[model samples]
Target: MSSPRPLNRRHFLRTTSAAAATGYFVGSSSLTRGQESPNERPVFATIGLRNQGWSITSKSTKFADFAAFADVDANVLGENLEKLEKQTGKKADGYSDYRKVLERDDIDAVMIATPDHWHTKISVEAMLAGKDVYCEKPLTLTIDEGKLIERVVKQTGRVFQVGTMQRTESDQRFLKAIALIRDGRIGEIVKVTCGINGATGSPVIPAIDVPEGLDWDKWLGPAAKVPYRALPQMREGYGGGVPLYTNCHYAWRNWYEYSGGQMNDWGAHHVDIATWALGASDSGPNKITPVSYSLPVEYENGYPTVDDQYNSPTKFEIHANMPGDIPLVITSEGDNGILFEGTKGRFFVNRGKLTGKPVEDLESNPLPEGAVEAVYGGPVSENHTANFVAAMASREQPISDVWSHNRMLEICHLANIAIRLGRELNWDPTKREIVGDEQANAFLSRECRKGYEIDM
Candidate 1:
């Protein structure tokens, strides 16, 4: 492997103050002004090199070079290193510990694809280190982490983008849908349904020895640690009859120890759009109730009882009374898409297609020319990563800002809390809290491992 050019951490630290203050809420270009040409491309590091992180980093290579790579799993890191070096024609420094990547002076930004538990810590630290960031969605594991990220963004003024790529690459359908709703084409949407599918379920996975090239401890950063459990890794998720085999990392989502099941997984996407359309992106639901829920294991105080079974709700419909008292249903039933029911019209959309009478009649009773573009805040971007790179140059907020995402994520987190408690809870959108339930409020944040905890 070709060695990376020298990165002087001391040199970087000396200029940290001035560098962080460069560019008035602009991109990392400000940091490279005197050292490199304005036309120079920014250097980046990918912190998690697994499934989603690899996909995002692979595409992001179109906009920036991979100067460094970090992952707790040595196997994934080594494989990504070979592939990235071959594809980019540039050797990158690989580190088992992510903190080393953050210390490098050459990397101007980082694409964080770590677990939901690690998102807030890494993103916040990356921004504070004078690096821009592209964080995967379900931006935080909790509502409190969401607020933490928002504060860091404003303080660091780093170019930030969440992985809600639908905003840019929905072929104008999502934007069109939002425009139609906002334009009153959908006559004040009274109800919305988000079908995200249920959480993955399985019998208790047996704990086993730690595998080679994997650091299970670091993988559980900020999350409560548990015995290593092997999850059934089928060709695909539920619905495909699986030959049972065992894996760990990919199965992290099935456990509440690392993620909030589908609530934060697909919920991150649909909930983001659903709330954005309501113009409640900065606020949250006024009330939340678990209409009905089925789980793989019993829960107490919003946590699973069993040690090794998948814990996310299997089949559940969470009812949310949004800011305007509009009823929002998040469930696994029906088509795997978002449905907007309004007084005047109705429509549905997902990664596959966007359709409904409103979309069909757009040719006749159409929105204004720039409706979709306006939702994007400008012209349509090439893709989500392209938007991140563009915003870095233009010093503008990318399509999915951190604050807006947190508002949406807050609802999903609350949904899980209400479901786990099996009760209705009152929420104050303005205060951003549960009205009278202390138990539910506690789930807003998790107690992080001492070393992994961040100052809030």
Candidate 2:
């Protein structure tokens, strides 16, 4: 398939603005057409059928038809397919390899919930294969990977949505929050604090035999091949039942090899909202300072020294010097939410609630009509996946567009790098590099393990 021209953002905004003026939203009109016809519904395939992979797909079935499911582990791939069939009475094909799903012409889009390391490769390939992509947050493992995904997205003209659902979901609380900020209810912004909860250190886990029906090598993918490690101890709740310390399952978030611990795990969600409210979606932090942090394992030259346990920082208080001299503190402390502090008033918001004086005052002094819709660029969707489907129908970028996601994610990535190196970093957001620090800049991108290099 030949690559098409990228979506014209300026034209889209103008059109949507005029539609909004007339009490009509651009995406909603076209999106309803799909629901009216069975064949018009986009066909979706999920690439990673584990925790979030299943969650997104389950929610997405409201607007799209599932055509296939893929996972490196056959066991996981099969279980999700059964679950999907039970829920929808639609028996879809299952594949252990994601490439097979991407190769199918019937699939119009792919929901990728793979590990951080694999996001860039699969997203690039899927878009190149003529499928629109809805990828999970912390859209990339590293800064350069974000650049690659951005390039592939623009080159392919795909309707890509990063899984920062706060932009669409969260009961419209986040949208209300942004609207308040834009409405100057908070006055001039002074400081913003993101209280993404901290992570816990893991015990030494011994290398164990790969679990039955698991493809260890395929799971490793672009990450360096290593012995599969697990402790047999089971986690208690959500994403539980699997080994609590395995490097291949839900516990992969604890390792730098596969994830960025809570920094990217939770940070991806909160930081994206914080960045959006700060009006810094197109810009980023100029400096990232590691105020204080503690890693579970030793490190040498920013590389983890041990291989048997979690290596990501368990606790961190990173200070990013953002635009307008605003201090954006990403700390593994306080509530798991965002606090927007400004000259006039302050407010806090999370998935569960939006609070503070600004929120309280809203009852007596309600926001201007259509305030929330204005913040969302149009009428809000039923959910995050609905916004993606709307974008699919309108052929426009979704609320969680790749360019803005990457911009916010760069702050999260730089925070990890700062804490890992135990120093402050000078970042040139425009250049997208660590200024004058070759050694630190080297961490911006990782070399893929042999035989797993991404095809450009």
Candidate 3:
């Protein structure tokens, strides 16, 4: 592995001289780069130390040295530090505030595993700090945040990899599927079903006192301040208990305030594959209609009528019409996977299996040489985080770049908005506008808490 360009005080000053104009470090560091000893590897920080954050940090130690850890919940920060230190034989510093971790010059990169809302804030700041980033899936909570991230990436020229690890893992099933579709093995593609099953919401529970050692205000961050609710604040573990319905942590996906439910939860992966097969990563749907939907609670314009219960759509079938003749269906009714149906044949794929006539034909006739490699943009790695570390050294774009993911996420956001409004809406991709419906258009962005506004 290539060593990161170590920044001394002078180098940090030089690289950050343009911070005022660009909002982040723009100049290149002058430190030499070469192989570093095992303990001297590039330093990386973990910003959110809960579920997905813990998983990513644990796996990333093989690629980068741990430098700092941050989380709003002090309990998580303390526990994870001991576990990581015991494994690596070195103490990785811990912090409750993420901005403090970003302020350090020696830190080379950061992995952002915060909730959907905090993804944009930490990612933008990390790039500005001249640090490469690995952010969890559903890159943004809203469509406008996606636009902001795309612009910041272009300005900073930092390496970024979304946590859609299916590209690097999955034993090439999704890649092969994309290659088959692109190579015309599926004939003329007419329709697709990206099935991401949904779930119900937490019930109307009374607010409880903030848990001991947790920073409730910082945990809310850009989200609105509500009385602390235990079920939505933490998961089954870490002083939280299981509820009759879904709870937080794993079930944060069930809430609209913190996430996009199943739409962004699983759609970040499958919808991306659907977009890839159609060669539409840089484009999006021309129109969207909510054929059917069932939210956990009543909604006005788009806000939930009640705060005590989960409110995101729990069951939905959204129709997205593309520039091409094909129409994409997103639903919670089918097996959890993606189905590509063309005039000639159809195939199904998920994490466990890939099936249908197309896959069966692979026995007699296979994808040509380098077909899978072509789809992956190059040689595939053993896992996804390795791909990100490789891109940091090569200074090349990872397989899942922000621009394409942003485009795919736009589709997911539109579907969610369509479901929320209970109406069909027209979209102009070129102009990035929702045609004719001002109320639907207003759903594209949101009101961030005043102090936490996206400055970019």
Candidate 4:
């Protein structure tokens, strides 16, 4: 594939200037030269204002003001509102519904930190409403959602930054290690082992009444209905009653209804890096074969529900066939980390550290001069939020744009589908569909609750 033309700063300036004059609302805030100017700080609202939401909102220093906050739980929203006011000394209105927040013309953008189920709906709607979005990672809950989001983004011509912050941190050893391997420092790549945790056994907890100030039904969104449990306590603030078993808030990652478990949670980060390094951001695996899997044992009532409460495979080995007939096997073992093996040697990387054949070998390895720039073109903004803001101003794609992100997301989704189906599946990247297996294909897109269907 040929390299895309590098976006020029002069052209970006002219485009943004024209867009601003034509009354283009980048997100929630209007572009104005004032205490709240898009040039200085784009006015913004935050949806799902809890946990990672706080961090995403806090990091928007370059191009956003906390103009509005939305959450299904009023308690969480109230706390964040106070925190934002205290820190930024700017008052922001609070709302329980995100639609109300999106309706405001004064806001220029929105930072969505909701669960996997809510990501696509809010993002597509926000884009349609003419707001740039910084949605949290894993992009979407299902493969079909990713494709839908990509289409909406293209159709609306809006800037979208998936919250893959690992892409920002320079010292992110995993990404750096991948960069090293992609440079042929590891010789011809053969296989990759991505380690992630299996789902935890469901905790024993009773369903509790919904909290007074929370909109429990709305929080469930497009996901299937379930009894309310206490929301898991987020590191940032308290959550509504959703329970640790359901992993309703942060732990939602463990359950299938809301998330793709570790395959997507960690895969969204590590597997993404692997794909990025392979320069296969536009496509995904041609086939996914599950080498091994450990499904959660059936349970009764409170002990262990026989029903498949957690849809993800606890332990599984999935082989992803990339271009050139190279097979990348992403396995789950020994907690979480990524291992890249090539003809010459292999290296392992995780949040903690990077280790391999020789430490000095990796340290000395570097990408061919402009290779990194070629992959992530445009001005490299070290800060992820700043990059989104810059992209909004420049009308350029952010580092983690919808297209590349969906490709990575597809890998994880395919892996999950393979494990769930308990068999190997052939994939046609061109068609973006599974071949031959109608049963497997059914998993791609889920039946959205009435009125929540995504128009593709």
Alpha-carbon runs more than 4 Å astray in model 1:
1-36, 231-247
Per-residue alpha-carbon lDDT of model 4 for 2-95, expressed as tens digits? 1121245345434544554543334323432223333355778899977789887877744467889999888889999999988888899999
Q: How much is the lDDT of residue 343 in candidate 1? A: 95
Residue 102 CA error for candidate 4 (Å)? 0.9
lDDT (C-alpha, whole model) for all candidates: 0.78, 0.85, 0.78, 0.73
Q: lDDT by residue for model 1 over 406-450, one digit each (tens)?
A: 889888889888888889989988888899899889988888897
Report RMSD (Å) for each prediction in the order shown.
Answer: 7.4, 3.9, 7.1, 5.1
Provide TM-scores for the models.
0.90, 0.93, 0.89, 0.86
lDDT of 2 at 89: 92
Candidate of highest lDDT: 2
How far is 149's C-alpha from truth in model 3 (Å)? 0.8
Model 2, residue 398: distance off in Å is 0.4
* Model 2 C-alpha lDDT per residue in residues 248-284, reported as the tens digit of each score: 7888888899989899999999999999998899999
Error of 2 at 41 (Å): 1.1
Clashing pairs in 1: none
Could you give candidate 3's per-residue lDDT for residues 1-456 as a string of tens digits? 122222232332232222212322111121223333322456789998877788888998876678899998888899899989988888988999898888887787899998898899989988887788899999999888888887787777777888988876788889889888877888999999999997776667677777788787787788888876544443455424433333244555677778998999999999999988888887888998899999888888878888877778889999999768689999989799999998889999999999999889989999899888777755666577766665664455566778788889888899888888888889998878799999998888888887886545
- In TM-score terms, candidate 1 sits at 0.90
* Candidate 3: clashing pairs of residues: none
The RMSD (Cα, Å) of candidate 2 is 3.9
lDDT: worst 10-residue window of model 4: 1-10
The all-Cα superposition gives candidate 1 an RMSD in Å to the true structure of 7.4
